[model samples]
Target chain A: MSGAHLLVRVGETTAALPAAAVRRVVRSLRLHPLPGAGEGLLGLAEFAGEPLAVLDLARLMGAAGVAGASPAVTVVTWIGPAGDRELVGLAVDEALEVAELDLGAAAAGAGEVLVAERPVRLVDLERLGEEA
Target chain B: MSPELVVVRRAGALWGVPAAAVAAIERGPEGVTVRLAGGRELGAEAVVGLSGEVSVRGLAPPVRRRLPPAVAGLALWNSEPVAVLGVAAAPAGGRR
Candidate 1:
């Protein structure tokens, strides 16, 4: 329990996602597909009549496959560019609760992170929207 | 209303089933027959309910569990409590 928040898994094993990057977690939804979309875009989903871009976090994390959209968590994040925030949706294996951790509590490596004492790939939320 | 279950057509064509539709969700070793929304009961090995949606992943055919708004409760597998989340229908495609 440091400055960084700890992630409570839906099942077992503690995984961490940046609190600042997450807006809210919701149940899985049918993602509307965008013609000629890239790899990360799970598809398009409408929330309250407003269309939202959904990104498959499980695929991005290498946890699941393309059809693994079922039983996933939708994390709405705001990507800011020059103070402009663009909203995006991320689908994960599950929505784990958030916990805070100290910045100096663990080691930090390039493209690598030891979150909550668990080794995981550090995701760059900012670059998530870019075409891969 | 309970959210709609998101369904998708996976990539890589295989016997009328796309590879994308084949999720890696775990089906229970001991499968159970479940009656879901569409008045259809399917035999599934394992099912996971989170937030409010119940998903029967890991099946070869890939069962997309849809929970209607009227249904609200914990999903029991082998008499154990599982995560429950809201369910919703994905757009025409899914995720992107």
Candidate 2:
């Protein structure tokens, strides 16, 4: 990655969502649970007096024990393709840091970015809306 | 134009039934009776009457496929989400 990425902790793993798409990393949101909502959706929350959909990032990554985890931050981001972007919130365990990393030797679709000798998955935000 | 909705607590979450789809709503000791225009009456709780201009956010396809058939979309009441109910979508009874 030649650009800045927002690194965060989702469950026990480190992941990155491009900084350009990240609008804010706020304190844990007071999310209103949606009854009968699927596991993917955390629930709706208020941001600037608007209802925002908050998704469980750890659950999307197939991480375990997300229900028991106390999410510390809500990463507000706009995902989806250009001109058709949708703003959504990601409930993550912690907000690490914004890092500038170089992935010159890795191939496209390799999925992992080397951060401090650890492999951090480059989160495919588009899938957040599409995934089951 | 968004129709006025009868926001009620049902099954589990807060649900909104279009006022146009409701024939009458009467509160008693049991709870609120959301009588539909089609002559079917369903029991609901915490009936918040005559909500106007409830802008709904259509559920994504993945979420839609998983939701109950009665759910139309999601909207807000005092900044909290209320599942907007389509016609004939109100819960029959019971808190699920």
lDDT of 2 by residue, A39-124 (tens): 77777677766667777788777765354433578898877655556677788888999998665533453877688888887776
Which is the leading candidate under DockQ? 2
Q: Each model's DockQ?
A: 0.02, 0.44
lDDT per residue (tens digit) for residues B23-84 in model 2: 88888786778889877666776686568887876655445654677777777787667778
After superposing candidate 2 on the true structure, give the runs of residues whose Cα lies further than 4 Å from its correct spot: A67-70, A81-84, A101-109, B39-42, B61-66, B88-94
| Whole-structure CA lDDT of model 2 | 0.73
True lDDT of residue B68, candidate 2? 70
Candidate 2 CAPRI classification by DockQ: acceptable
lDDT of 1 by residue, B1-96 (tens): 232232212221000111122333323444433333433333333333322233321100001111212122222222332212222221122211
Give the CA lDDT, 0 to 100, for residue A120 in model 1: 50
For residues A70-110, what per-residue lDDT tens digits would candidate 1 score against the true structure? 43667666553434445566666555556554444334454
